[model samples]
Target: MAAEQQAPSILGFPHRPEWGAAAHRRAVAGYLRRCRDHARIGARQAARCIGTSESTLSRLETGLAPLKPVEVERLLDVYGVRDPAERQRITLLVAEATQPESWHPYAHAAPNSLRPLLAMEPAARRIISYEPQLVPGWLQTEEYAQIVIRATHPTLPAKEIDERVRLRRARIDMLRRRVDPPVLLAVMDSEVFRRQVGTPGVMYRQITYLLTLLEDLRYQLRLHIAPLSVGAAGAIGHPIVHLRFFAPEYLPDMVYLEQYEGAVYREKPSESERYLAVLNHLCGVATPADQTASLLRQALDTWR
Candidate 1:
């Protein structure tokens, strides 16, 4: 006979603005602790009821370990938690825990859990990326990469920065893995291409590198330009990306947004729809891919 499953805890809560997954763990731990206290139960007693050791219970209660659904329900039932709202909330949390975490493995023990989502996405069907402040990491040249990495993380040790840069370069290898790689379309501000980021030499080489990639036939890459005029139409934002996953079974699109500390992967239909709208606006206003290629040639000429 198969073993029976425990009831799931309620889960739907707006994630915190910072430390998203970590914050969720802390909140669930706090809720569990309150339940225990209300029951007047000691750690050992709670542990016994949940089929775990006292140390395990203590770690979970202290928010040091991620909460599991079975453990949540077993403990809650033992504590006689009868609040329907709390029960519903715990149930929602359980569901969120089970949702596919695209970036969970790559994330450091710290707060950057968001990085894994994009890295783990089932290869995207199409990718639209725009960056105004810097060269996108996927297209950055090695020397340009070092300068940007060092500038952004002044406090980080030189060795650590080198390791990170190495990893960034390695990630680019993903572009050539498949027979038909994802279609890449990018738009950059005119000034972004003109400004020298690392050194005059690095800047010159990076521009040339971009030109070389434009001619790569194997990777269906397309480049576009969004001039300053388009900026007035609300085309300006942190490097925005719209990736469409080719999941034949699922009708919805997945969208991801990244910030300095973390990112959010939005699978909700509404969120996906909003990004689609933004992408349409940007694509319509930006210069065509062929024209952008000409502009890139012009920029390379100016650099020489």
Candidate 2:
């Protein structure tokens, strides 16, 4: 009897050429290491059960090579893990981790480790971004962005920081130049306008800059303020940049979650849905756009 065909190795996800398989390799290796530790099984013993040499298992665990899905199943079975839910979860994660990150090449300009959720920008239908602390890069004025870059990256030499700010400003041009640009939706917390990163003069200019951007018909700017009554709920956690695309293939909806030190692009259906829910809740709790603008205007008037 013929053996059943094994599932395909995740050669590339989203079918990009410069995909990075290493991230999945590392994640799978980490999982295997943890599993081995939990089961109190030595590499040689586990390797014997999985029909691989001890050194091969060591290499796989250390991410020197990719682990086959069948081998992964074998390891889990030998560990005597009986929980069906956990088994399915492990198998799914193993597949996902192996799926190549198609955005890895673009990550060169940014940090190499950033798991950015970027598809073909030219094909997206709508781009929704929310920032509670700083101006979204897409809407930032040149000077305001410079002040932010300088203040946050004090260690970088002034020239390098200037170049970085310039690159950031250039990215904004896409909103205007793209033939079919995504309808840009920006929702900022009122405190974003109030937070003074530079001189009073610089901040005044920044507020005016945002007011000017609001004049653009294509810019669907919906600024809001989280009230003090909401307490910490109003506080911005990590900035979330969600992108929705109009593709017939796997491309659909994605969320780009950013932290100061790292970022991850979440394409998993459940994760994407959860983020959308969080945004909806936050929007419901936040003050209306007009009120947010009024609060911003008031802050600008009081800034000096």
Candidate 3:
């Protein structure tokens, strides 16, 4: 009888099981780029050493393409990576990068532009969000989400809308249930409360939910209201989500900007830091967290 084939071992190198596939891919790409630079190898030289085109190497380094195990080994060899433990760890990263993300099932309902953000949210250590028009998706109640979805995508069928709502709910539940949930600091313009999404009832329920989350000690959430009273403040005037990961992951901070048709992602430190600055300004100018509940109550009164 033929002997059973065994999978190759990772030599006991630990991989971050909590990170999603997107995070792993970015880490692998960043590590490969750093290794090549550290070895004083140009892109052309590295590509030639690996017997591939520079464009392919560029894609792999940018996280646009996955690196095969053989390719990883060859790159390590070329980069003079002699440390056995480092090799094992990178090999494990490549393996994990190829795995499916939890958001894969919602791919059909989610826009291609938004999938990357979905995959990265779970792996983030801190999420700083700013909303000028409406409540952020992570804090939206079901009724509020449904109304927002329908208004935003009037052409989408009810079934598709329901799927989107479910996706948002899943994200909220994941954060709530996570043992070490990311620290969420959300800043919302007071106009969000005055916008009146669905109905007075919906707005009331949603604000109540926000208050409940703010009061819950178990959640690492901080809410701030950018009061309309703070007129002409230095605000970004659009929605922004800045996600920061732990250092051990080797992942860079990412900024997500949503537009009407598509979204834009800023990964460069300079670009992301600009957005971070705007968010920081908003946070600084906004009502303090302790006073947020009062603003919420004022809105509740207005809705009432």
Candidate 4:
């Protein structure tokens, strides 16, 4: 039962964001902390209650160790988390935790612990993202995605690129599966389209895809274009993603900073609010989502 999950996807390869399982792990870890803290219990005391060593409990709290379903139940009992609803909520995460992570296959490419992003993506009520370098992954067409991957990952073999592109496409498809798909507010710079990725044709097709998405009000996509005129006011050097959760207890609001080495997640209210502030500033200075289609069209025409 300790085996890591490798849930197969209809996309054929492991493309499902391994976030749900990761989310479950995070939820379990968080629930235990709250229970322990509220009861004014120490790790050693809690460990004694649950029949585990102090170090083991510490590892669990820090997310350094995986918890078995039995362990979760035991910990919950010991922590005085007797509320049935709370128990059930935690139990649901336990089942979710059992599902396999899809990123295990591509661990070679994305070595970072990005499972949190995947976990939160499906459950988020809204996603506010700012992309200054290129198009956001979710909005990219296959051709555009290939170009980005090839340029950034020059050393990657063709097979791996194909594998990732397929997985990414599957991730985009995933948005349709959620009962209430999160509202995606994506702000990107005009330079992303102005720059040549694969060829003029590739850029045109990408712009076309964005145009289609922009017109589809039903898709919950609000796309804003930050022109060169806006300068550094609307963007920083890296991509910023803010995830807002519906169930604050199980999942917390987060700010994700994409770095070349890996990803950084900020959860503290104070730290995350700073990123949110930047996003708000960008929105104020940039073109509205409703007006973005025309700018996209102009870029597409220039590419032609």
Candidate 5:
């Protein structure tokens, strides 16, 4: 009897090299990494084939390094990727990655660790983002974000702080485009309102915004507040995000965990399953969607 084929080690995604027109930068970066792993080539070998250093190759695989079209071509050639459709898809990803971000200077303010997530957002079919600390970045208003920026980076220059705030604010629009946007189900800690951020005014406005969004007739957003009763029973202390692609075989779901110095992306099936289970538990314990708006209103009244 033949043994079952083991999943690819890199992205843990099913293989379909002949997929079409994948323009998402994150998807491309992931695809490239998987191809290299599928070919069983070491970083040194890839660097030699692509005329770059091992460190550079590592960064490219992690989506940290800026990728040029020619570089993608070189890497693909060395990885033995001969599929015409896959080549075109990767080439399109190169174009998308090289395009200028419209948010300009603000967009440039975010660190490399975060850039990949933003790139992935456009391509994600569904997103499950959890925050135990405070409001999720995408849902935060400018005033609330300003307070967060100051508190997080107390020593940052005023100009720089403003830039960071604008950058975060820009993230909201990234998900609001009328075109095909990913469905976001943000599960947050119940302490969000109870926890003081900047001032009562800021907290009030932010809560008000949350209330509005929950009531918004037009969004695929599912805002769930995990009640304080659940407490430590929830997932780990840190934040977690799981991103699923439209084409399941094209790129496996990725779990993103952010730390102080950097972030972690888990593509392995086992790791992703654990995170997904935690999120499901949190969702189960969280207030029902119908009651989320009411809870926000109660919190909003306290601010008033």
Candidate 6:
């Protein structure tokens, strides 16, 4: 008699409808790594089984290389993934990973480093952001974003500038209108209010917009102002965003550190924890969320 068939093991890849290509790639990479670990196979052995170099497999696992559906199937076989359901989910992830994201059109305007952050933003369950010099991008008003972009890229063509602004607006609308939007905890230095971006009217309007959003209960936004008196909360003079996803069982938290020219993505728990620690420190030093509205009103008075 034939041996009895075993029930398929469920490998939980992100099944969300809102997941973009980047998210799918992330899921695929994570799933592959986990599957290999479960099978107790070393990278060299697995790569040999799949007829690929260990370095090539390393790139696939790190999401630096595209994962084709055929390659996924071969890797699954090598990793002893016998469950059909698991295989199907992986196939779907591979398909999704190859698809274009909403920002694909404006890819020319966005730096390659920034693309991953844009892709991951929609999938985040909660976002903790600390901006030392400017308002967080997710919270910036259209006018404010335009002025900041123009100032940063003085030589950028007018048309490209417009495209970048539109991309920013689109991102804001998408996040704002989500059925289950990510909770946003944003900490900005008090110096951000003092550092003028555009005209006085622009600053006033931006502050008013921020106040309105702070009062609105629908957005799930918590705004904090790190007072000048705090005097260096140990967050370096850059922006840090730590994104937490809904599926902690399979997905790991990510930290995005934005530099002057590019950005870095921290996915390992050890690396992400350090940034999370810095964010926690900033949160502790910043004024409480309840007092944020009053601080904004005071800043508004300065513009007035």
lDDT of each: 0.65, 0.63, 0.82, 0.74, 0.74, 0.81
Off by over 4 Å in 1: 1-113, 217-219
List TM-score per model, in order. Answer: 0.62, 0.59, 0.89, 0.85, 0.78, 0.89
Better of 4 and 6 by TM-score: 6
> What is the per-residue lDDT of model 5 for residues 103-181, given as tens digits with 9 covering 90 to 100?
4455547767776566556567788988989899888998899888788778988888888888887766645756666
After the best TM-score superposition of candidate 3, give how far the Cα of residue 129 lies from its true spot, in angstroms: 0.8
| lDDT preference between candidates 4 and 5, better one | 5
Best lDDT among the predictions, by candidate number: 3
lDDT minimum window of 10 residues, candidate 4: 7-16
Collision pairs in model 2: 24-97
Error of 5 at 277 (Å): 0.9
**Cα deviation in Å at residue 301, candidate 1?**
3.1
Residue 182 in candidate 4 has what lDDT?
Answer: 72
lDDT of 4 by residue, 1-304 (tens): 4333321111111112334566556667776776677667788888887788999988787555777888888877766666666676667666776776655555554445465676567656788889998999888899888878888789989988886676566556545655656778899988888778888888888899888767764477888888889976954999999988655555668888888867898998888888889998898788987788778878878888
In model 4, residue pairs whose N, Cα or C atoms come closer than 3 Å (at least 3 residues apart or on different chains), thus clashing, are 5-100, 6-100, 19-119
Models, CA RMSD each: 10.3, 9.7, 7.1, 7.9, 4.9, 3.9
Candidate 5 off by > 4 Å: 1-26, 29-47, 53-64, 74-86, 101-104, 260-262
Task: Please give, for residues 1-304, the per-residue lDDT of candidate 6 as tens digits.
Answer: 2322332243655566575677778778877887787777899998887678999989888777788888888878877787777878877778888888757879877778888888888778888999989988877788999999999889999889888887876766545654777788899999899999899998999999898777774467898899878876734788999988866655688999999889989989999888888898889988999999988999999999
Q: Candidate 4: misplaced stretches above 4 Å?
A: 1-19, 48-56, 62-64, 102-110, 217-219
- lDDT for 153 in candidate 1 is 75
Candidate 1 shows a clash count of: 14
Model 6 Cα shift for residue 266 (angstroms)? 2.1
| Residue 209, model 3: Cα distance from true site in angstroms | 1.2
